[model samples]
Target: MESDLSTSDYLDQIERLPTHEREGQLFWKLRIRETRSQLRHLFANSRLRTSLVISLSIVFWIGLFVLFYLGFDFVVGQVGLPGATYHAQTVQFVFTLFFMSLQIMLIFSSGIILYGGLYASNETNHLLTLPIRDSRIVLYRFQESLFFSSWGFFLLASPMLIAYGIVVSAPWYYYAYLPGLMISFAYIPCTIGAIICLILISRVPHLRRIVVGIIALLIVVVAYTSIWRTLDIKDADLLGAAWFKQTFRRFEFTREEWLPSTWLSNGLLEAAREETFDPGDLPWFESGKYLIVLLSNAMFFHVILLWVGGLLYRSSYYGLNSRQARQTHLRMAWIDRITEKLLWLLPRETQLLIIKDFRMFRRDPVQWSQFLIFFGLLMLYFANIDRFRQHRQDINVLAWVNIVSFLNLAVVGLILSTFTTRFIYPLISLEGRRFWILGRLPIERDAILWGKFLFAASGSWLPCAILVVSSDIMLRVSIQVIVIHQFICLMLCIGLSGMAVGLGAIMPDFREQSPSKIAAGFGGTLNLVLSAIFILLTVLLTALPCHFYFMANESKLQTQMIPAGNLLLWLSLGLIGVVLLTALVTIVPLMGGFRAFRKLEV
Candidate 1:
């Protein structure tokens, strides 16, 4: 009988054809095939189809890099002194602390990625059933996580490093050393993260919640510590000496001898400051120590990870696949009761949809953890407003207060936009392959869209309003300013939520399972771009009136030329324009979303 095996089957047979080919060669072959398949699918459209898309993407990335480079260059120039290495040290300290903090965050995030099925793709699942060693599987997943997590670091750090190099006039070897350092730095996190995930899977599955809670506690502790350190209210004996001492002490912690950040910083700075470039007299032994430390540590941890995986992979994989009852049922029941009481007034269908959305959000630790981190960081920054005021005495205090409040509005609006893009924009698309079940229900698509909007808006609005009101209170701004900012935040909430929902519905992607992937598609890109533009315009509209008022007030006091009545007339017209713009932004996108969702073929 003729063989009826498919190509994949034939490949498998060929793989088993040689016993020596089962380990490294087999893994590479599978990986190569998988990568090529993805690439082909990604570029399946005709050449003309995505030309505009490609052009826009290139422009966006180039603009981002240019913006960062310019910003870093400006910082270096401003901070550089005529006869000192002060600017270089400052930059090194900042980079070290930043990378250290990022490493900590990556450890927690990696555990979540593994536990939450973020890497549980169809290909990975299929690979698990094959004859490949579990160590190879772990290695593949580690590489995937590392690649996904490192891009942001590369984009952010490259410009700063390049700017630092330019500021220091470093040699070519200094530039060459940077990529190796970065790669090693990236490897440390991936190795540590993989180990964390494996340990959690093998030892304590139920401890994930506790780990997240501990991370939250750590954030709170750090926030409190920062506030305490920065908000010293003791009256200083007014002398130039005290101010100089305080300024010098600001970064004392960065000089600690024990930190990896310190090592990395010192290494980079030493390499950059090398005065000789002659091949015979290179500072190999001295400058090379940091690189060796970084590389050895990375290799050490990665080897340990592989060894641990080889021992624990089978049990952990089995445990990870097993279905265990979640322990939060009682807490969820209590929340459901509260939700029921709150939504008793809504229609039954809407109530059910809202409840479902809440349950889904609550069950997903990856989603909620991210929400916590993003907003928690914002809150921490907001909590430091009093400290900001104490330090910024050069400008008119009230003028500074108003400026910060207005800028706070923009920042909070931008946060809302990001939240909507990351979470809300993916909701409709996240229905995924089971969307047909919704079609079978007796509910209207409008109800579904409305529920998502209301839920997302209300969720986003509370935090944003708190941020606005708390900052205003901290700054002791006038009640008028407080109320105005609150109003603007409310309008922003509606507009952002509406735009995300509408754009998501219009360009739903049910094929992609990951929220991050879904949000990186064309619709998500457009939503982000439009949302950013909307925020800019809104800020300008609101700020224009305030700017006019401030200018008019200053001129009235200084020159007595501009009349108060003229100022009032301009202010009234500006307020009217703002109100109209807010209404249009709030309403149009929501209606568009509803209509688009209704027309969607289930």
Candidate 2:
């Protein structure tokens, strides 16, 4: 029947065939059933986990809302900039710039998610054996990938928009239109991302890592130059009204109509004015016209993806499977040699395991690429610290600098927690059904766990410490502040790594093959919750002395004398508390994980 009909009618003919061959419908039906089953199972079996995740999400959302509310309030209250026009235009430019940058991120994130879901997944491989068209599987996986790619967008955007709505006295409908607008806008980048991932895999198939690396480098360079130029203003008043005007003017190029982010931003801005786009008049809105553009473009992409996506997925799937194998030598022995020499203090078994894990990490573009992008962005921000802080003296300067330093520490710690949860927590689980082979090896199970822990701790610490130190140097903070930050960085790395490794053993998901799937499971969620709580305690304990010292110094900037003895006493207490806390957090989980690993049947 499919052959009898033209290509346009192919889908229509599928329904007339027997239900068993109705792969498209079957896939979706199965998906629906699976979703319902998973939700039910989650609520029935893991109420605590469900409640904790939801609660953290709510708290984080509320925190973001409050932060934005205060920022918008500062602007509208005539604190940050002058004039109502400056307020509106500045915020509007911010909205456009923010969404435009977010759009770029979604494209990259969506591509990565799709690459993992499509070409790299065992599930995709299994699905190929079924009767479904490869496109349906791509669509199926796209649904999952979209959720992973876009959740951050929703989390970050919703609160800011709400704050904007409240600040602008927007109608109730602004909040109502918000979700729909965001959903539509999200699809635009994700579609572009899907197309990019498709072309890369189907065309290059090999050399993907090199090509992706070069492309990523170019984007970073472009972003760096753009940001550097934006901030490299000379002779302009750093704390002047003109600075706001000139800085935001550079982003005016994105205010054009054709861009989806522009439409989204303008639509929201207009909606706040209790108006819609008039298309022909001087009114700010498009009278829901921009919203309609988003919806229509989103729909167009959805349809296009189903058609074009299927063809690309089919070709890539078959081509990848049938591609000829090439024999090439890996030039990474130098890495092993260097690592072995550095880790010579450890036993040979543990050293070998560390080297193995290192090789695996270095070989996988997916893992290391994400690691670089996230840390690279943070370091890039740190490098431009002078842009944010003027190289001048002022009342309470020491206090403000002290506060910012601790905040940067907390931020770095938070980001490190995510990496540990995503990558470290899944390591043992990724070992999965291969444990029997490992059991037969002469290496001890303790060595296996220690190797992972050491690998995570040592690997994470250097970069985090460098970032913290670099930010401090840029801020021109005192030597005492830098020394404290370095100490905290070391503690955070060890504690967080141990926590993830420990939790992985305690809640090993041997059944799941995908690292992401494993990471998204209960263990990863629990690990994140614990890590957050741990970071909060660490920051509070370690920062109290520094904060106190700065407040005193700020109170008497001229001939100031905070007693060295008193300062030393407080510092000692703080260090002791932080060290004890770090010890507890690290040792407890590791011991638990060690016990669990020892008793495993495999």
Whole-model lDDT per candidate: 0.71, 0.82
Q: Which candidate leads the pack in TM-score? A: 2
The global Cα lDDT (0 to 1) of model 2 is 0.82
| RMSD to true structure for each model, in Å | 5.8, 4.1
Q: Poorest 10 consecutive residues of model 1 by lDDT?
A: 236-245
lDDT score for residue 520 of model 2: 64
TM-score for each candidate, following the candidate numbering: 0.82, 0.89
Expressed as tens digits, the lDDT of each residue in 1-602 for candidate 2 is 66666765866766564453466677778889998997898899878867887887788789899999988887777733322466657677888899998999888878887888887778788887765766677788888878877887998899999997788687777777788899999999998888788888889887788877777677767767777877777767665777777777777777878888898987887666643365554323453778889999998887787777778887887887788887777765887899999999999899888898998998877778777777777788789866767734566666767888899999999999999998999999887578888888998898899999999999999999999999999888888789989999999999999999998987788766667767766678778878988998999987888788656664743334658468668878988888999999899999999999998874
Candidate 1 lDDT over residue span 1-602, tens digit each: 23655776878865674353457687678779987875676578434424544665566566666776676667657766212456655566567667777766666655555443323566667777777666777876776667656655676677667766776577677787888878887778777878877876678656665766677667767756755664553554222446435544764675676555666676677667755566665543555788888889888998898898778877876776685865664344778778877888989888878888888888776677777776777677777777767666664766777888889889888877877887899999877366789999999878898889888877788889998898888887777778778877887888888789877876688766667656656667667767877887777776767655765565455446656676667667766666677667667877777777777765
Query: Model 1, residue 115: displacement in angstroms?
Result: 3.2
Model 2 bad stretches (over 4 Å): 1-24, 79-84, 275-287, 326-332, 387-391, 550-564, 599-602
lDDT of 2 at 186: 97
Q: Candidate 1 versus the native: TM-score? A: 0.82
Error of 2 at 164 (Å): 2.5
